[model samples]
Target chain A: MKISGAQGIIECLLEQGVDTVFGYPGGRILPLYDAIYEGKIRHILTVHEQGAIHAADGYARASGKVGVCIATSGPGATNLVTGLANAYLDSVPLVVITGQVSTDLIGADAFQEVDITGITMPITKHNFLVKDVATLPEIMRFAFRIASSGRPGPVLIDVPSDIQLDVFNFTQEEEQEKNKPRFQWELSQLGSSLIDRAAAVLETAKQPVMIVGGGVVSSGAYEQVVALAEKMNAPVVSTLMGLGSFSSEHPLFLGLTGMHGHKRANLAVHGADVVIAIGSRFNDRVTGNKFKYAEGKTLIHIDVDPAELDKNVSTHIPLAGDVKQLVTTLNERIKPFNPSPWWKVIWEWKQEFAVKPDGNDLSATWMLKQVAERTKGKPFIFATDVGQHQMWAAQNLHIETPRSWITSGGLGTMGFGLPAAIGAQIAMPTKRVIAIVGDGGMKMTGCELFTAASQGLPLITIIVDNSSLGMVRQLQQLFYKQRYSESLLPVPMDFVCFAKAFGIEGTLTTTQEEFLAAFSAAIESNCPRVIIVKIPTEQLVTPMLKPNSPLDTFMDI
Target chain B: MGHHTISILVLNQSGVLVRVAGMFSRRGFNIESLAVGTTHVPEYSRITAVMQGSDAIVAQVVKQLEKLVEVRAVEILPVNTAVVRDMAMIKVKAAQNKKLEVLQLAETFGAKVVDISNETLMVEITSGKTNTDALIDALSSYGILEMIRTGVVGLQRGDCSIYEKEKCEISALFDTAQVEA
Candidate 1:
């Protein structure tokens, strides 16, 4: 059947099982909006393009589906840059569609025209400028495939207005067949040898530590990770992105390992004879002072992407393949190994340097504990914006299931939590989604409260209002002799009032009891609610690695 | 740190060059020189980039470049087992006193005099990067006026071709391969 390009886009989306779209329309994209109105798709109009993209990212991370977002050309597309970068860094699968000027006016610098593909080149997984309506179907298909495939990330499609209005032939069956997965590369023969080498290393090691990264969750390798850890009797440490990949309550599970990671996790990594790092890029935060990170230990790195194999730390055995497959194969080939003595040493370290709150007062730590206790045994998802609050949440929150924890791990993006919560809530309507934000992070994208209220998302926004860029301030206090400067938010606008301005119920709580009460009330209300938990500037993420030090070289806490 | 020559195979599409260069600069890898052109297959292009970095840095650069969606494959051209060449055009101030010597020197390096004017002579050479540099240096005393090089392009010294291998093994190598019409 012959159909307009707009109809083709709608048909393709429905075929892909996409039910909701987060976007804001403009003049150049009017045809698409018209198609959306006539179609059965649910469209969400966000306060800004940035909010729309972040929400889509959150939705993708929470629901394990490719989240979709749309915007017009130029400024609208430009606004999605930060959100796109956030998704790219965290490896969230997203498909972003931006309207462009008519084909003839694309390069004439037409009104609201921007080379969005060029603008987002470095940040997106891939991007395309649709010059023909005939190619729309295939582009849309590949956009989703590329966004969700190995080491998923965001992909963009820039469509001109004329293309949306042009006519094209559509055949459902043929198109569906055309979009089937085209390639599945088997594990290279070399991979088998690499796995053998890894198993051999594990066999000889007295102390072997398994460091699970976000890839475990992305690949749904949690079960395999557990089996491997159990078989080897090695303690498991997770990266921030790997929070929920393994049960926090597991006996072998140590807390997050990195700059703000748990002391036991860091010490375990330090004393390990072999380090098996899976699905992690080993960023600077994870490997403090790269020269000393995993220095003497034999490193076994497994990832789907070969690029990540030797990008950071050199590997004694590089097993480049799907984490799930690689671990499963290792499970079959390896004999049972024991590390009881290693566990004893780790348990002692855990006791000697347990993560503890510094003060007895109502603090971020105290508030997180209250939230955790209140939300226990409930279907819940939590996201955090970058700051001291994020580290505190990472250090304190207990994630019970995979994909239950979401945060800006790679880009350290502020203003991510609230919008992300909106996306998560939209994806899983029955589950409770919460945003944990610092005063500074909330201020950056606080306007997203309008999006939540308008959508009636039933999300709970918890603002840890420290009235400063808490992380930077903490760093300056430790390194710059406490010469606090622009880090402080000089004029503290009432966050409760700010939330109220967006038509959401707001509460300001100072004590632990008050916070719990407000939090429970918000949960019960089943509507968008914002609770501002005021904290002092001295609140810090302790047991941190000092500047230019090794991962094991922590501050004198 | 030393200069490393890297080759990349990418889809022949718009903005791919910028994407490759953008990533290089974003990761703080300085590009010493870069040359790009279509390969035997019109659907793909080859980019040869020279950058100075440690072994780790070079490995990282190749790895990061490979992460780009348009890129199909990335490999570091080994210095010993590869053939490297550069094309350069140098215009020297060849007044009456030095015209013969400049011509002789250019001929010695297998350079052709492309253009000659009253005060200058333009010499073109397509040779190894080192040899091209040598010719330019030898003519520097003759008051070289201007010079432009096409940068370095390299290929392995073997019957095996990276492009052909990728064409056949793409389905067997990458998890996601673009289906050709």
Candidate 2:
């Protein structure tokens, strides 16, 4: 069983059920590359380390398993930070392995030596630097456990050059049996008693509304949420991160509720007699004008993270546990209420606040709706970068399952989509994967297209090009008196040419006919493809309420 | 303000001392002194830092420390009957100085001058906060120039270390139960 550290890595990955890894080989990681060559694990050589990490992230989101990425130390390791942070914010499970300098020369500032473990600590759930060859198997097991457990996140393991060259006997059974921390959802210990109290509140309330967040998605509790909502006969509003938790087409579904949420969604929250919040930390953006948000409503908060309860809005009842379990238990105890009257009132508001884009026949919003339709009922993963396109995708995409929509919510990290798409496609090869990105965001990590092409991941990327930072430009145009400063990127590179250079099929569309053709063609392609849709620069995401403003006060141009 | 025990795991790399010390200085967290050393893993190190701040401020400091990429895990360990120790190596000018007074002071504080030259005396002191402070105050009058103190290393008075015993037991029990099942 004596195997080199590099061989042990491949063995450990295979043990963890990892079939492929995204990485680029360098002098420091030559041993690992050689081992990969000798082993059966597929290695997708990315053009850049950032692309590797993003591809891994996409894979994790798409597959619902921990994605793996590898890179040499120093610059290569630093490049993965953005993608790591993206996965961290979105709660995607990822395991990143980086090659380090020799143990003896670790502190000598040797070539390609970087303190990756230290640098990645804040961005990772947990990280380890393997100095001893014996610890490699244990560390890899521990990394996978930590990355995939609790709130899923990215974990980094740095293996020194000397350790990679060292020999070790790593028994598969021993490695598999390596003990690690387990985050269990004990009903009693997690304060499930509060659910009874919350049920009482839900039972008596005249108008009850539900606010769901990304935690529901992370916990795979979308069905539970839908069931609870239907049983309660309550309208469900979602945070941007909570997109696709409830069927947008469902009668009980209220559009996204936040700073950029629909006016009716905000109004519904404000007018509710009782608010049942599940798996969502009431972030500042979601609770605009915090003092007045859900005014006079009895707030029943349910979250796994204890710190999130009563952190922003005052809660009458708080339940701490996994959202899925809590909702299922609550569904059994609570009595169903008739919401036809309340639904009628909310539907009227929804109709009044409904947004219809003008002039631009095929706007980004329209394109998203079309994409959602074309993909059919099969679960297609959507990874989005931040900007107008991200919000549009969140508002438009119909997510029927958990982990179907992956986007940086808390950190709002740009350049997240392309890399995340790469990860998702790798993780779930059978499903269609799409990266919906704005022009600004696409340019930030557009290089990852080459990574996608090289892997033949069959990921389809749709870039909403408006020749500027559309979100900022809209804000400046609407609120800042049209003083667009440092928001427009002049000499914008041709996206089609960029994708073509990466040896990937590319298309640019300016009209509805062209857009449909381009999108249809990209989806049919065997390899990764990019489709750029030219959008009007003046287009803005409508029904926008100013930050910290009441739901009643909104500006729509 | 109450005493807070901050446990930090860091990369066992050089310049870590300077970076950590500088953080304390810049943040003005009156470092009641610190103790650092390599852990069981050579690549990883542990540093126990003691500071006095309000609960809110201490939590803020812990959050800030956690934000540092170099800092691995940071937890505010509860200090109830904990064994905390600080070691200081002080070099005092012996010639024409109060050598007997310094030695007497050191003796009273259970400190010893390990190395002595004709003109300089190297005193090593390991004690609690009060004793360390008293020795520093007494030695300052004798022209104490060079002093290197190994911040503060501490452990709770218990049967075993937290990570070693508690984590191992829990994980072992879980593993055994899984295997048996």
Candidate 3:
């Protein structure tokens, strides 16, 4: 059956199991819009392109599938750049389709003829410029495969205006089978060898520590990492990205290490004889002063991307493969080593770095804990924007499995949580989806609340109102001689009024009691709910390893 | 860390050097040296960078470079068969009639005496990294005053291009592969 390129796109999406697509139509993408109307796929029209892309991102992070977004060329495509880059940095799977000008006018500088494929290349996992109708099927399949594959990210498919009208004879099943190839983990073999080497190193070490990163979540290996740590009787220290990989309540948990990490976690990593890193890139922020970070320890880094290993710190055994597969193999092969002294020392460090907020009111940490408890063991998705709220959530949230906590890790994108939560909720309607955003980050994409309301997704948004870019202000206060630059904005917008404007119930809380009530109400609300918690602007993320310093060289709080 | 050679074809424009350099620095990819020059094509320039990293990371870097808007193509040339060269200009203090001896040293290293003044003698040398190091070693005894060295520029011999290899791999998988025809 011959079908238009636009219909081919719809067909390809349906074949990929994509039921929902978030987008706004324009003159350039009218053909695509018409095709979508005729097709069975559900399309959610967002008020803005930013909202559309973010909603798609939210859906992807929550569901662990490729989130789809469509937009016209020029401004529509440009608007989605931030979200694309956001997904790229955080490694979210997204398929973005943009309508381009006619193929003939592509380089003539015609109206709405922006080179979207080129513009998105740096920010996407892969991209294709489809000029012919016949190529659409294969390109679309390749786009989804690339976006959802190892180290998932955004993929852009720019469909020319002329091609959208052209006819093609291609069936969905034939295209899928032809395009999809087997992706095996040959790297896992290398990973197994490295694991044995790591075990050997661990056997001789007196104090061993496991440093878990976002890769564990990416690989759905959180439980395996925790089990491996417990088996080794070792303490677990996490990077900012590694938060939620280990339970905060676990006695072996040593909190986050690196810049803005806990003091004791930094000390634990610094003093350990062996440091086992899983699914982390070990960015400079995590290492602080690299010279002093884990100076005497043997660093064993296990990551899916072999490039990440020894890219930062020198490693003894570099394991390159899937984190889950590697951990599972390691758990089965090695005998549990007894490290009683190491466990005791880690326990001491945990006590020393006990993060007890001075005020008894529902602090950021307390709020996260409450949410974790309320959600129970049932699979729930938690998304967070950047700043103190994100760190606190990571430190406090009890994530039992992977894909549970989604945050902008690599990019540290601020306006990521709410839209991501909406996406997650839309992808899995029955799952409880929560987005934790700070005042600064909330305002960045706060308008996304309407998308959630319109979609009828019962997403719970917890806004930590700090009235400033808390992380930047804290840095300025600590590092820049207390000169707070443009970090402080004017009087904050009324979040409650903002939520009401979107037809979502909103509540404001100041004390711990009020927070508890508001949280319960928000969670219980059938419709999308927003709760604004007023937090102090002066509060700083403590136990920080100051910038340009080693992780272990943390300022003692 | 083994050394690797990466060739990037970028749109000829200003600030491209800074943009490319910034990417390497931001990603923490250590660049031993980088050289950029105009290609045979008027609108395009070729940038050659020599860096040290694991094979996996170098491949990732190549993929990242290929993604840059200004970058048209990226080729990772094997180090063994590639010819890597660097250019250096150094000014050395010459007292009395010692200029003849310095010129002699320059000639021995296949260097040319570009300029000669009463107080200083400038020598220009273009050679591989090893030869450059050796020349610099011999000139160090003359109390080198000022020096400028361009990073290594490398090119592979013959027609065995990286793009050709990639195309071959694709072709091997699907016999119908014919450059999107």
Interface RMSD list for the candidates: 7.2, 9.9, 10.0
Pick the DockQ winner: 1
Model 2 pairs in collision: A54-A419, A55-A423, A58-A420, A58-A423, A58-A424, A59-A423, A59-A424, B34-B151, B34-B152, B35-B152
Model 2 Cα shift for residue B84 (angstroms): 9.7
In the order shown, the candidates' Cα RMSDs to the true structure are: 2.9, 5.6, 7.3
Task: Choose 2 or 3, whichever is better by DockQ.
Answer: 2
Worst 10-residue lDDT window, candidate 2 chain B:
B172-181
Off by over 4 Å in 3: A175-181, A187-193, A247-251, A357-362, A489-492, B1-181
Query: Each predicted model: what fraction of the native A–B Cα contacts (within 8 Å) does it retain?
Result: 0.29, 0.00, 0.02
Task: Put down candidate 3 lDDT per residue, B14-83, tens digits, no spaces.
Answer: 5467667767986888998898999777866889998999886887687556434456667877667787
> Which digits, one per residue and each the tens of the lDDT, describe model 2 over residues B1-181?
8888887776676546655666676567678767788888776688888899887667657655643435655667666667777889999887746667677778988999898787778889998767888888888877887999887777777675545421212231111101000
Q: Candidates ranked by DockQ, best first?
A: 1, 2, 3
Model 1 global lDDT (CA atoms, 0 to 1): 0.87
Q: Ten-residue segment with the worst summed lDDT in candidate 3 chain A?
A: A180-189
For model 1, residues B1-181, the per-residue Cα lDDT tens digits are 9989999888787788999999999889999899999988887899999999999889778767766767887788899999999999999999987888899999999999999999999999999988998999998888888999999999998886776535332321122432210
Cα lDDT tens digits, model 3, A1-557, are: 88888888898899899999999898789899999988589998877898789889877876777899999988999999999998887777899999999888879999977877667656776667786788788778777766765667798888888899998897766655656454455534555577788778887879888898877766778778878987888878887766767876677777777776777788778788898988888888788776667577899888776556666776888777667777888777767887888667766766776767646875777777778788878868888888989888876777655567778777787787887787778888888888999999898889888888888888889998878888889878877888999998668679999999999889999888898898878777788888988887887776666567755555554
The global C-alpha lDDT for each of the candidates, from Candidate 1 onward, is 0.87, 0.79, 0.79
- Computed on C-alphas against the true complex, the DockQ of each candidate is 0.32, 0.09, 0.08
Q: What is the lDDT of residue A176 in candidate 3?
A: 55
If you assessed candidate 1 against the hidden native complex, which CAPRI class would it receive? acceptable
